[model samples]
Target: MTETGDLSTAGAQNGHSCCAPATSRAEAVDSHVSHPGADPAVNSESEPEFSFDFVTAGGTFDMGDPFGDGHPADGEGPRHRVNLTEFEIATTSVTNDDFARFVADTGFVTTAERLGTSAVFAMLLETNPGAEAHILGQAPGVPWWVEVSGANWAAPEGPGSTIDNRRDHPVVHISWDDAQAYCAWSGTRLPSEAEWELAARGGLKGRRYPWGNRLLTDGEWNCNIWQGEFPRTNTLDDGFIGTAPARHFAPNGLGLFNTVGNVWEWCADWFTRDYYQHSPQSDPQGPDIGDKRIMRGGSFLCHDSYCNRYRVAARSSNTPDSSASNIGFRAVRKAH
Candidate 1:
């Protein structure tokens, strides 16, 4: 039930990936396709308007899995204490509507849009003959992930899919670089790993989830994670098959919505498994350099049978240019 190896390595070893497909930009490129350059826009001088609700959080908190149930290869154990200054974090992940506004204002093109393809859970695609045409190929080892051409945030499932009715849903197919672009344009930044954990913990000292140690409270699902067998069957016990609304689930004690499940939220940290071994006690800003970036808050695809990263202390990472249908991000800023 518990995941043992890192997602990137485990996927290759067992043919089952955790959370989402973790392909790098170099791995995404094909000899037949031409990739475009990233958007050149920078942060705007004017204050950008955001409709998101922000929750203020600050204090000393236990930062890792206190129960010692986390994946050792992921560096989720050896629970550490961290102190954070006052900061504001978005209550919900960035919605399609929110990302739309950012694109409208900055004309920023996400990495997926530029590359002309992105990783999408194959089950999300329509069961039609033409659906196969949009699929470029399947991710190595993770056959459930199909690299679909034109599978950007707007058309999450490929050419025919649209975000028209899912505006309230968290925007997916977002890479770390794409998230950074949105942060720059919004005059906000991605939450550091420490800040993110504090907000996710809500006011609790150390618990398995934002709500408590149990996955369910009174037989009721607390968040939007997979309820049935993963990669093959989802029982829809949480009222969602793919991504849920950005504000679908109950807020944590800190008023953060879907902080543990819904979609994987990117953090402003370069990922390193051993960082916790020598991390700073105050405001540890991940490692200085790394090929991958941190992603917290396991996605709707998380299932106890395979990926139990929905737990509050669970951690994972992906390449900065990796974009997937289950990946999204929230913004944060210094609180006055």
Candidate 2:
């Protein structure tokens, strides 16, 4: 695996190879597109209410990579014990339907919407006719990521794409700031990196996946992920080429769905590679400050040959304002 002195900084500078493209706000603004008005059907006052099924999680568990398979630069090592107080995490990532309600209620414009473009996987553009017209350019070094105008949460692939049929899928093209806005509207908060891992483990201990160390359970795929050669062909072995329905897979032991796949969920804490070395034994809240926020759980694009960050302990990060097709988030709250 290629190692950068600072993983998040490298991602911001040249985009992640196997995950979301990291386009800075200024980069996106240079190729701005007119912000289309919100869809009346989704932004109307009569939109349905949004709710989340949260599972209670807490207690002491080992955090970090037990298998030592993580990239050293990503800081998934020095496995250590951590104690966490009770907290509740959503069973699945926040979906388009959920985010639409937040937008409808508050009329908040996402960072992507304001910047006027978002990064999309170039492979998706191949299947979408006329999408190439919206392409601003490829992310530097990573040609697979196509920066597209009008590619916000509402129009995931570009101007003509819509989330109308993907209401159940996790809302992609979401920046950390976008998630924070949603959390504020919902009276919830993003999970800390520690809290996120604890909940993702689902009452398990030192396992590669939430279900166990094995990638497949009982000869069946347990999660959605890249099934074939990297950046080329996908066999659709897990039945999805992109983001799957947020709640599609079997729930983990603690009843969390798609904990390590589907989309990379943003965490509340800022990222630092060596934070684990100095992390507190209880309730580690990450570094005091940093340029990027932590992102956990690999997305549908993750493949073992390239980016195998789907492991429970694996972590990555991007700039707070960066938005991409493979990134999304879930909310957390104190357990009463």
Candidate 3:
């Protein structure tokens, strides 16, 4: 099955591309909610509204595909140096608990909720066969993606599943537009693609995985990604078949956690394959206008066999309005 491309473009050969050619550019920016589980009161007046810790990073780093074998469709090559200004980013992707609080306070409706549907992994549906009735459609070329009704952040697997104990896990089924709403309410914003790569590198230079070149070191898995196979079977060798806690793995040099896997974190940049060819050298902010938005890192669905986009330099994209079970986000703030 060939999944249709969104608004981003890359040079990878695999069908598992968020980095594929996009449709057409759109004018408006994207919106953020719709997680399950209740949240603690977030009192911005008295208590700190945003509780996640932030790591400050600033330096010049090569921000594109540092290696030759990476998905050229991802446009990861043409590795260029980018001088980034200091910026603070969340230690992890926004948690379900974090998003819950935003939902409780604002009563905001996520695009998934508004659309009354979101994409669910077919594997998940197989686990809960009852939900098969709710299947809306399948993403072309990616048959595993079942667009199921009621599969918002609240009910991740259509109608039967719940995020009950997964509150600390990164909230999924979030569109770029939904993430933006959460950021606005929390007094934060999504990271630019460059800022995201810089932070993901964790002070390292030209390394493949965030922890280094080795995907597994000392018989230990570094991040949450597909284990045995892609889409067919997940050995759960990483202790998780789906999303794990935001802080499940060890942090990188900058003290950021799970920047490479678990979920595809949305970025503020618009999607474009050639943007890197002429992007500003200092603090580049993506294209002036485009159809899709950028997504970085990768998700639990990512596997080296198919989607190796979990690498720091790899990128993918979707329309601002698109949301999926593996698509979540982290936020960023400029240092004062």
Residue lDDT tens for model 1, 205-281 = 88989999888888999899888776788889889888888877788888888998889999878878899899999
Please give each candidate's TM-score: 0.90, 0.89, 0.88
lDDT of 3 by residue, 95-200 (tens): 9899998888878898778767777778877666778898866655666677787888988888888888888899998988888788777767888899999999
Task: Tell me which of candidates 1 and 3 scores higher on lDDT.
Answer: 1
Candidate 2: worst-modelled 10 consecutive residues by lDDT: 31-40
Our model 3 lands, by Cα RMSD against the true structure, at 5.7
Query: Whole-model lDDT, candidate 1?
Result: 0.79
List candidate 1 stretches off by more than 4 Å.
1-16, 27-42, 127-129
On a 0 to 100 scale, what is the lDDT of residue 99 in model 3?
91
| Best TM-score among the predictions, by candidate number | 1
Stretches of candidate 3 off by over 4 Å are 1-48
**What local lDDT score does residue 187 receive in model 1, on the 0 to 100 scale?**
63
> Higher-TM-score candidate among 1 and 2?
1
Residue-level lDDT of model 2, residues 189-287, one tens digit each, is 888888899989988887899999889878899888888887889899898888899889889899999999889999988788899998999888788
In model 2, which regions exceed 4 Å deviation?
A: 1-9, 12-17, 27-48
